[model samples]
Target: MIVSRTALLETLSAVQDTVSQLIGDLNESEIKDIEDYLGRICRHLRCSRNALVSINKLPSEILGYIFQFIHADFASPSRSWIEVSYVCRHWRRVALSMPSLWSVVDLRQKGFDVHKLEAFVQRSKAAPLTVFYQNPPSDHLVLRALQDVVARNMYRVRHMHVKADVCPPFSDVILSEPAPSLCSLSLWHKGPAFPLLHANSARALFDGRAPLLRKMTISACALWYVYRITSLTHLALYNSEAHWFGDSFVDMLDGCQQLEMLFIVSPHLRLATEVEQQHSNRIVTLPRLHLFYIVRVVCKCYPLPWLRHLLAHLEIPEYCDFRVEFWMTDREVVPEGSILSIFPPPAQFHPLEQVATVKLLTTSTSKSCIAVHSKTLFIVAHGDAFPLGLPNDFLCPIARIVIVNNTETTSFLLWRTLLSTTTHLKTLDVFEKYLDTVEFIQLLCPDLGAEGVSPVRCPGLQTVNWACLSYPDVDLLFGLMAMANDRAHCGSPMRAISIWPSVNGEDKRTVEFDSLGAPMGYFTRESTDEDCPCLHVVEGLIAAATPKRPDEDGW
Candidate 1:
């Protein structure tokens, strides 16, 4: 069924040309239909090409290569490659004949036919499989099919990700013959733990013999079950219900020497409780760790000292909602009267060379929050509130600062910090709402500064992006325009300033301007014959803000 190479190329060329033409004409419905057709044609072509060749004709090495290309992780089912078999007979044969490609079967979809499921399991040819069940099966037929597939491939499964939407039927298959090749396992329950699979049943899956197992994730399970994973490298436990105390959780960590990445998402356990006191033993060693993320539901005491012992680098997002405890390592904590302390001992030890970026994100439900700190010097604060104050000496050699969701006061403070203090600052981006404040405009052109000293002074300043500007906010626009004009008048000149207006109701085609005239630095705006100079000024600001790459240096 494979078409000639020439025919395939011709089809591809035609499809590309058709798509390009459709793009030129902005008819969305027609474009979508054409895209669908193109996808079908591409799938069909792949199927046809795969079917034409015999297995023996291709070398075993080449066959393995083909298998690698086809074998996919079923975790992402929405990908187009999943439909390889549906293209044509040739593709179906190639796909079916390749056992490695069929190995990982995801049964998360509801109402999956048992017969087809069984056939897929059989076709996988003993290669390791990962069965995912996201939704509950409506009938016993689908359940039976799943049981049969698991039973048959019990020895071949490398990973089993189960999200039990309904109570599992505890048949012989549940109790018998655990998967020997299961190297990774994840279980997620919708509500509470099902009583049928008791602690013993949960323990049966590990049974002490998965030496190859490196990763395990469990949700809403007893802490005792986690003790069985002695060889884990990556472990994640979410909402391990209230009954499972933190002592057992700490005890479980004692055995996992190889554990590297530990993620505890939404642990309902409290830190101040007696259970935490009972497990005061520290994890003294975890040399191989590079990354750790903890998202706690309830406020917990600073676990930083313990984490410092384990990891070299960490990424904790602002919304994690946990307070950190700072415990100094024996080597780091300074002793009184020590000669070495004269140079001002480092207060805290961070393995990284510098704190790169800090982002203050504002959420709808919560107050303005300090969210992220990357190793690169970029600060982006978005909120109606002022960012928490930092000491003048707290050095952050930043290159760019982006402020979004700002009220007038927040905007004023931000401008003060950037214009007066932050010497390394380069680019400043203020959204329209922030610039609307008259106070912010006054701060930008502060009168208290040395006579004739421009309030906005960033020697390294390159670009400014002012978005959503309007007629009401024209004063703020004039201030920036004045700065640009002054800079141009001086020997040293600023690179660019870009402005995007809040064009809502007024017709863009018929907009007019009075005799105030276009500013000196304003770029020419594109307009139908009736557009004004104000629009031209806005366009000029935009042109200045656009960044230029090194490759385009001359241009």
Candidate 2:
């Protein structure tokens, strides 16, 4: 898999050439590589030959059903489901017969020229067309073909995603005709595609005939006129252009009463906060909304006032998944308490317990997730720097917490503030990256006699199934032992401590506490690299509850 590209290509050429000619062109080292390549290819061919009969035994109907799963998103230029047509005569016939197979067209593939696209359209027949065109080149011929092959078929188009830089004429022609079957429309104006598509032009989209439109996504420009359709269930509005969301943003949500999911991404909320209190008498009620996600990038406005202003006008349900993220790649530090505005008040979505579960997620790209059930709301954060802490007013009753580590070096103060929020924390799970195991144990260790030391954080913290470790060292074991003993000295006891090998093998360190909150005996796992489970670790952590402690002690 790691062979050089040149060597691979040379070997391939040698296989295609005559043996006499291949030997003449190669040195001793090259000859050995050629033989190895030939042997591998021969094995591959033999395996394919042996399995060909059984695979071909499948009926055409089943084969077609299998082919349906292979869509345009899964295919690229070098390889594609279209390759099935060249396998044999029967396969080609089956592939050509299915109109639905050609419905989803990806116009980005270099091989799919105007003629091939036209052929696919003819095969698709009356099937509802789903077209994806991204980064269109500045070529007259290709643009003309796209306008003709796709823009002309507006009536039958169901889903259209166009991310390109086009003059007004092409953008206008895309939805010039009346579309009765249009359901989903996504337009991302990346490179100065006539910003906002002109207010007047967007208002007359689909010739005012699109009734079944339910989902619409507009980025780089906000098409505020889409509220004309009443059937919209999912709406996503992302505007990077400055001065876009004037004052009608809340008014726009108020118009569509059936929205189930709402996603918005902007540099900052451009709403007039004075409108925050002005709309107190008149609230926008989205009764069907389940998920509300908002992202702010290159933040220009303070998050607290703007977010609170937006939420004050909306009526959220009791049980909804709300996520607010700050993506300030500009490396500007956010204010200390601005994060508290991320959560809506209990009056908006009054939960039964009034408590929330929190999750903080950070990937290679400095993203943190915090989830809250009810009273104390937490969420997944998308921030450039994780400097701020979960302030007191942010949320309360944090019975659950999840911390997924990636590349960014998290601050000790931020982690301290996070764990200090709740005392009844049942579990603390972390995925290893930059944060060292020694550093984590240091956080749990009590700063008993230090000057002006804060109280112990998450004293009642329980089951911890550690996911990342550089290696099993004497320092790590000593730190774990210290964490157990120090926390016990603080009066609130800790629970089962599970340690994973430097690689990956479950190592449980169940520490039993006496009545007075002190560790009696605990389990520790010692292993060499060979003893550890041979697993390749990757990024991302799954949200899971810490396993319950068994009746017996360390095993």
What is candidate 2's CA lDDT for residue 534? Answer: 26
Clashes of each: 11, 19
lDDT of each: 0.50, 0.61
Query: Candidate 1's C-alpha lDDT?
Result: 0.50
lDDT of 2 at 69: 74
Number of the top lDDT candidate: 2
Which 10-residue span in candidate 1 carries the lowest summed lDDT? 337-346
Over 329-403, each residue of candidate 1 has an lDDT whose tens digit, in order, gives 232222122111111111222322244333322222221222222443233333222233344334456566664
- For 420-536, candidate 2 gives per-residue lDDT tens digits of 666778777766654342344556655321345554467667666566655334444445556666666766556555556543555433444555554553333332233343221
Q: Could you tell me the lDDT of residue 350 within candidate 2?
A: 46
lDDT, candidate 1, at 89: 60
- What stretches of model 1 exceed 4 Å from their correct place? 1-71, 76-94, 165-178, 193-197, 201-205, 223-226, 239-245, 268-279, 296-407, 411-555
